[model samples]
Structures are given as C-alpha cells and as structure tokens.
Target chain A: MARTQGSHSDITGPRIREAALALFARHGYAAVSMRQIAAEVGVQAGALYNYTPDKQSLLFRLMYEHMQDLIAAYADQDQTEDAAEALRQFVGFHIRFHLQRPDEVFIAYMELRNLSSDNFAQIEALRRTYENALEAILRKGQAAGAFDIADTKIATLAVIAMLNGVMTWYRAGGRLSLDEVEQAYWDMVHRSVTA
Target chain B: MARTQGSHSDITGPRIREAALALFARHGYAAVSMRQIAAEVGVQAGALYNYTPDKQSLLFRLMYEHMQDLIAAYADQDQTEDAAEALRQFVGFHIRFHLQRPDEVFIAYMELRNLSSDNFAQIEALRRTYENALEAILRKGQAAGAFDIADTKIATLAVIAMLNGVMTWYRAGGRLSLDEVEQAYWDMVHRSVTA
Candidate 1:
C-alpha cells in the first residue's frame, strides 16, 4: 500500500521496530512480508519504509540492536575483576537478561542464515564482542590459575550456549524459580571451569 | 503445479524428505511452502502430498527422525554403565552426531515453534527422552559420588547445551580438529560437572 499524506504521523520508531521484531521472530525474516509487518504496526506498507528501508535492514537492525543491548546491559551490570565473582555474575546476568527477551534470543540464534553476508558478519562481530566479555574473564582466570579451561574461546562459546539453553525450557511457573535456575546454572558453570 | 498422471513416478519418498529438509533448513518451516518443496524435489505439488500430508507433517518427520537417529546412534555407541564414562561417551557422541547433521539439528531446535500443539508435544517428548539419557548418567554419577552436582536434571541440560554449542562455530578445517573440539568440550563438560 502506498502511503497517504501523513499516514505515519501516529507511528513512533520504537513501535515499528517492536512490531518488526515480533513478526520476524514468529514467521522469520524470509517468510514475513513488509505488508504483514505494516499490518502488525498498524501502518501503511509505504509508511513502514520510512522507518526501515527493507526487510533486510529490519532484520539486521533487530539483531544488531539485540547484541548492542546485550553488550550495554552487561556493561551496566556489576562487572568485577574477580574472575570467579565476575563469572558468577555473568551467569546470573546472562540468564536474567536473555530470559526477559525470549523472542530476541530466539531470532538472534535462529535467523542468522537469512541475513546478507555483510549483515551476518556485522552480527557475528557484535556477537564476538559480547562473547569476548566472557572470554576475557576466562583468560583472567586462566592467567591467575583460578580456572582451568582448555580453550578460552571454546569455553566462552560453550558457557554462553549453556546459559541460552535456559530460555528454551525454563517457564515462569515451572518447577524451578528464576533464582534457582540461575543458581543451578552458576553452580555448573563455576564448577566446569574451576574443576 | 498439480500432478499429471504418471508425473510422480520419478520422485521417491527419500527425495521428498531430502528436499524438504534442505528447504526448511534454508528458509525456515513457516517460510517454505509445499510447492517450493516440490520444486526442489522436481515433482508436482500434488505429487509431493502423496508422500507427506502437509508442511507440518514434513517438519515433524524431520525432527522425529533426527531425534530417533540420535537415540539410536547413542544406543549403538559404546554405552557403558559407569556414570563418568557414560557422560564422557555422551559428550563425544553428541558433538559428532550433531556436527554431521547441522541442518537437522538447526531445524529441530528452531522449527519447534511452528509445529501444531499436538505435534509439538510429541517432539518435546522425544527430546525429553533424549535428554533423559544424559540425565540418567548424571543421576548415576550423583548417586555414586562420581559427579558432584547440585541437580542432575539441570546439569544434564547444561552439559548438553554446552556440547551443542560446538555446531554453531566449529568448522572442519579450523584450528581444531573434530577430535580436538570434542576433547575441548569434553574437558569442560567433565570439569563443569565434576568440579
């Protein structure tokens, strides 16, 4: 649909992004049309173009923003030099942060294949940067002999993937509380490196 | 296109499945259509239906077979009674098995949301049964004081998650061989629970 005059006057940037995120997360980037996203946002398809150039941009933006938000949240958390404490904090922080945004987490992992090569590389870089935060901790622990990890990079990937696993099955009123889940994960994570 | 009489003789059941798996993995379950799958398989759209009822059935069959194959392979592997040894065997088996079938593994985790409720339940049951195999090892280890874990169930998930992470970044010609990758993961998996 072509945009009528001032058709998008009522729409905000975040509202469009939110709609795009939910739709892409549900139907996937390749499957979802711009019109569907526009319908979800209650905007004309032409009006949607004002916020994002195309579906590719929307997918990249969502993934980039998710990674940036993750990096920012980790930065805002109580980061410490104590390797064990920092690792422990990362466990709780990662689980809580990811649990709150299941859709974003899902797309971040699932929709990588649909992004253009440049976009994929961009997302991977952001992911690596986020990963480096944890890898740095492992390196510190390895340096201090506090943690005995075979490969810091591989271990970093392993731990992040493990934490992400919580989002798949952990429900709010399930048998385990969020605190217990975090504590349980922290115990496994802490032991895995320390042992 | 609708099938013409005698137009379906060339296509086989395995060919239909192979096409469906590739399409679904590339474009996601919600995005790929039966027509598209038929195109991939060089068959008429109606001819595709003669093998599988619908897109949902195709998705379910792919995931079901993957899980069944995983369980069967694990059973075929040297399944020992010693908890520590069983866990070690699990880490190696999971990494190798999942690495070889990246597309199936990707769809199995990513496409679950697209399944009907009943289909979802069936797949979840299979997944839980698979997870239980590892959990049983953790439980035995816990009982025998071989593994010092707080919760066997969570440990099972965490360990599996940790191992599954390999499929995301691991490449064959990269710095590490499959042996090294499995070894690195096994080391972390062993320490994560044992420590």
Candidate 2:
C-alpha cells in the first residue's frame, strides 16, 4: 500500500503503535514479533519497516510517546498555591490517566526490561522525570506543613505504587465511577502523608 | 545425558522451579521458552519435561505453590482476637512473604495472563481465597466498630495493592529492613482504615 498523506494522515503509524502496545501489554515485549504486530495492524510484515526501523524502535516509540503525552497532560494543570488542592489534582490526574490508557501504562511499566540497555536508560530517565514531578508536589506539601511524610522518597514511591496498582483492577464498567474511585484513593493518600 | 536419579534428585526439581520463576518473571511466561529455562537450570531442554509436563504447567505450579505457601503461613499465625493485632500480622506476613520470594511474587502476578483459561481460573480462585481472608479480617473489624470503611471491597483491594506494590521496588539490601518497611506500611494502613 502507498503511504497515505493528509492533514491527519499518519494513520499507519498510529495503527502500528496501538497494535504494538496491545500486544506488548498482553504477551509482553520480548514475546511479540514484528510479524505479529503487522498481522494485527492488517499490513504486510515488510510494510511495517517503513514506519519503524525495527521492533525495538517500535517499542521505544510507543513508550517515548506515552511518556511525552503523560508529561504534557500534567504540564497543562495549574500550579495551585494550595498544597492540598495540588496534591488532589496530582492524584486524580494519575488515576484517570492510567485508567484511561491502560495499554500505555502497562507497556511503560512492564516492557522496560525488554529495551536495550541504552534505550532502557532513556525510558528510565523519562520515568524519573514523571516521578520527580510527584515528589516535587509532596515536597511543596511538606514545606507548607500540610503533609507529614517521614521520607519524601519512600512516600512518593508508596503513593505512586498505590495509584498505579489501580490499573490492575479497575474496569471500564465497574461499580465505582472514576470520581468515586479517585476520592477513595485521595482519602487514603491524604491520610497517608498528613499528620 | 543420562538422567541419573541422584544427580537430579537432590536439587533438580527446585532448580527447575527457580529457573522457570526467574525466566518467567524477567521475560514473561509466553516469551520464555522451555529451552531457555533448561539452559538456566544447566540441563537439557528435554530434561525440563522430567520436572514439568509443559510451560503452562510450570507457570501454574509456581503460582499455585506460592499461594498455598501464603495461605499456610497465615494460617499458622497466633489466633489473636484483636482485629488491630490481626491486621498487623497480616501486613507483616505479606511484606515478609513478598520480599523474600520476589521471583515467585513477580511471576504469579505478571504471568497469570499467559496461563490457559482453565489454568487461569484455577489460579485466580486460589488468589480469591487469599483475598477473602484479608477481606474477612476487614469485615470483622468493621463489625466491631474498630475500622471505619465505607466499602469493604474497595478497602481490601487498596490495602492488597499497596502491599503487592512493594515487590516492584523492594531490594534485598535496601536501607529499610523488612521489619521497618512492614511497620511503615502498617502505619499507612492503620491510618487509612482505623477510626
């Protein structure tokens, strides 16, 4: 098939990326072959090379783009003066982001080890940036005397772990609405770090 | 390549299990071939069949045995009547169990999807039994007015998720001792649910 081009015409690129994310999430990164992704995307295996040089590039792009999207979303939020409100926004954003794009979240977390060492380092750096954003929020909260965390590092890890764990169980049609789930998690989180 | 009974007898079974666990945890169940597992165990690929019928059986056994061990350990705890004490024991047991056997813990959680539907169902049922044990404790605490949870199911999931999250980051020679980590987690758990 000829490469299609238009204002929003990177259709094959997105299709390949989406197919890769789903397969990586389901069967893991190392287990999924380029041919499998091509089959899922309804393209010839060789045709995939036009989009990605290799499978590693495909995995790297999926993760890199996902991280960029995550950071972009968080960057859009206002930096509130109120520590509690800022923390709430952080928690709510995290829960909703992971719940909405579970395939990306799963690939980002589960497929890191499959990347080559250099690629792994790049992804790791992006992940740390995301973590640091949360840690910065916790530090601000601590500075304002709104939180009472003993160790900011451990506290940040614990909170992120708890938030990320939601992806394992949250269902699209679950009994709890996203609002209610976010509130419940925020309740635990607030109590976790506040005096 | 004769399978000497004594050469295989002392450690082959456990070795095969350990190698399989690590490979499955690192590469994922579908990604790991029996040949890779045998190489890790220093045996012929066919020799692995002596211990496990197939890859799926190996995966199922690792998870099933881990759950069984978890249930057994918790069963042996002191039958204290105080719900707070029971909760503490549960948290402590989980931290110790997960920290010490992270390979099994990682495989059990990450590789479940690779199991056949029938195998997955069996493993999930075993997991539900463990969850119910925790939920039962929370329900009892709620009944006694010691705990203030609006939703028992959600509360149970939150606590387990936090505990399970430890395996992702916990390192053997980490600064925090197992006891210290357990205490910190219990502090969060107590604050989140207790009145």
Cα-based lDDT for every prediction? 0.85, 0.84
- What is model 2's DockQ versus the real complex? 0.55
| Residue B54, candidate 2: C-alpha displacement in angstroms | 1.4
- Which portions of model 1 miss their true places by more than 4 Å? A1-11, B1-11
**Steric collisions counted per model:** 1, 0
**Per-residue lDDT over B25-61 for candidate 2, one digit per residue giving the tens place of the 0 to 100 score:** 8777777888888888777898788887887888888
Worst-scoring 10-residue span by lDDT in model 2 chain A: A1-10
RMSD of 2: 2.8
CAPRI tier for the interface of model 1: medium
Chain B alone, TM-score, model 1: 0.93
Q: Itemize residue pairs with steric clashes in candidate 2.
A: none
TM-score, every prediction: 0.90, 0.93
Superposed Cα deviation of residue A60, candidate 2 (Å): 1.3
Stretches of candidate 2 off by over 4 Å are: A1-9, B1-10
